[model samples]
Target: MFLLWFLACGLVDAEGEPRIEAHRCAAGYYPENSATGCAKALEAGFGTLEFDLVLTRDDVAVIHHDPFVNPEICTLADGTRLGEEEADRVYFKDITAAEARAGYLCGGIEVEDFPTQALVDEPIMTWAELLDMIEGHPDVYLHIDIKWEGDLSRPPDTYARVVMEEFWARELPNDYYVSAEYPEPLQEVEKLDSSVVTSWSWPSFPDGESTTLVAIGHELQTTLGTEDLVQLANDAKVDELNIPWQVADRRRVEDAVASGLPIQLWTLNTAAGLEAFGKWPVEALITDYPAGDAP
Candidate 1:
């Protein structure tokens, strides 16, 4: 099925359209990181799918954006909704995957940000499960963002090894790249296998105020200059640059492009955003609304 799609419409064609990566598996239309959401994104014609990966206490990698299950999008197995305080205490690193699957059901709640997302009850998926689901879509590309909390998570080497093991075990024909904001995990991946492609994401703020254009622009100007960030990617031997849309100004985009590596701008869901950033020669645009047309 995917082979025919790939042959019919490759990511880039004669028209030179930028490839679309389904961010969090089309989070705007379906539950973020859920299997249903991922399948829908593929069915919707998104060749590349992006999602997050975190490890359980048993060293099993799971498809979850945060280290802890988000209360806003999940409910307890017994049908009780989780509150912020209670959910914060339940870390993936402290529980086994079976315990997580048996203890909680994710999705069904309406996410305030994703107004159009459908409500569906589903279990948290494991890395193996995700691989199995995409088996039929052999040509689909994967953009895996590894998640971990500082000090509270396992060692970077261990985490990287586990993720790599899962990939090796499957040995599927899909083209994929793994990424992390910090360089340690990617560095560990390089050590394990230099052949694997990796990307480095930058400009993450410690104060959690990194979302807006102003804050990200300020950080780029002051502490995390684009030149320096590109040099950091070089030092880490990363194959691509995964940059936030807000900070991907003309200068930063040029700097990343100057590095001769592919640049992927993320989470641009609006037509205005697509129009603004589309002028740049980015390799791909990661978005929650892959089916949205830019006017």
Candidate 2:
């Protein structure tokens, strides 16, 4: 079933148009990672939805972009605002899924960068809840970005097992893939279930334009020839490469195509970006404004 769906995804690239994956559930139109945003994206005809995942204290997966609740966009359950320092102390790993849903509300304030985002108060969503919402939309593909930044308690292998267990239990019909900046989590996922598809997300550059990272280690990868980067991804056993648009030059994209591995670009929201990157023969373009007229 997934094989057929993946082939259909490739057909989009064959038509010279990269499939658009809604980043954070069309965050430019709705609140980032909110259930409302996800529903809106599906309503707006998005075939692919990308979201972040983090485990709660009880090892339940929840949809959230950050490890900690951000005071800038979230408020307490009683509608009380939280200070940045206070919000920082509330880590997802430290709270149970029930506590996360009942103790806080996100999307109360607009993200400064997304000027047109709708301001709607919403609770955090469990992985089960998200799956239920999208059950009717089986054609929709999911790009799950795992967030495990060096937490000793939740090692990469443990994280992969927990997430894969939840996924296997659901027996979802929709096609999906897992992605992470570091390859350990993806490698572990492959070890757990070789049938599952995994994407290797490249760390962002130091300009801070991207959310993932901007370390010296990534600088080396970006500086390397496209073949070398593709070889590295092959070594990691990732099925695809999720790259930042800033460094996805024409030559590099062409080289990746020659290597026969699909490349997906991220966070492209502008008309110019869509116009420019759309010319590349990549597999998908992830954007915050999938419902907008930009693409």
Candidate 3:
């Protein structure tokens, strides 16, 4: 308990800003997403929730990281032949929005298997559903990641318009944020809403990177000094930058702090890594696993 507070207190960015954020509490893991994920994350007292949003063939919102149903968490109704992996057999492409709602088994054979998880028999969540959830939880910060490019094979402005319009309609927490791996799609979001009120994914770093180690490669190429990143984004006139902590350098981290743009590091789940990012200029963080101790 003391350690969490001390670590939290030690975080200071350039100009002495503080950076800290909860990972994917909104997207429950081990048990997959459920009410449990949402409930527990709320209990952990996170300032923001990072969640991935995907679409079904029926055009419904499904909160998942991947396009397929991982067999580790899914099974046939009973007669369908099992495959090497669940993902191989079950895909969002095959499942309609209706089918997703019937029931789902994620990561384990049964919900009871993972007691800590939210085991739900409902279909995957849709965008409207997620938005409604967010509306209800006004206090939580939303770090929404758009998982669809809109056209699947290509891109669609609808992806941004739909989500962004709804966000504005609900007048969700001003602290809430949005990001996307597809910069093109994100550009749409930026164009639609240019206010400085929202938060973004991560910072865009420059230089060159090596593929030697994924992490090392990121450090070499994607990571930059925080200040430089701010200039890059501002010069480009973009709204947000989703950066990986592994790739961010002190200059990049510090610049983000001074600029007042929300900073969120990626995939951090370790105590050491969390502590390290906390010490930087980051304003928020995205981790795969919630430390649960929630700062």
TM-score of each: 0.87, 0.86, 0.70
Model 3, stretches more than 4 Å misplaced? 1-20, 26-32, 77-95, 107-122, 149-154, 196-218, 221-237, 259-262, 288-295
Candidate 1 lDDT for residue 164: 86
Best by TM-score: 1
lDDT, candidate 1, 1-295, per-residue tens: 9898989773332225578888998898889999889878777768899999888899999899887877888889877888788435678888999998889888789888888789878899888888888888887998888875566566788889999888888888899888887778888898999988888877554423535764556565645444455675788778887888866666556656767777888879898887667767788888888887522
Q: Please rank every candidate by TM-score, starting with the best.
A: 1, 2, 3
Q: Which prediction has more favorable TM-score, 2 or 3? A: 2
Per residue, candidate 3 scores C-alpha lDDT tens digits across 197-229 of 333443322213333455564455544433356
lDDT of 3 at 142: 71
Candidate 2 weakest lDDT stretch, 10 residues = 204-213
Candidate 2 per-residue lDDT over residues 1-295, each given as its tens digit: 9998888774333347898999999888889889998888887779899988888888888888777777888899998887777434578888889999999999978687888788899899888888778877878999989877655225788779888788778787889999987788899999998988888887523222453444434555656643365776878888888888765656666777778888899879898888778878888899987765653
Which sections of candidate 1 miss by over 4 Å?
A: 1-15, 207-227, 293-295
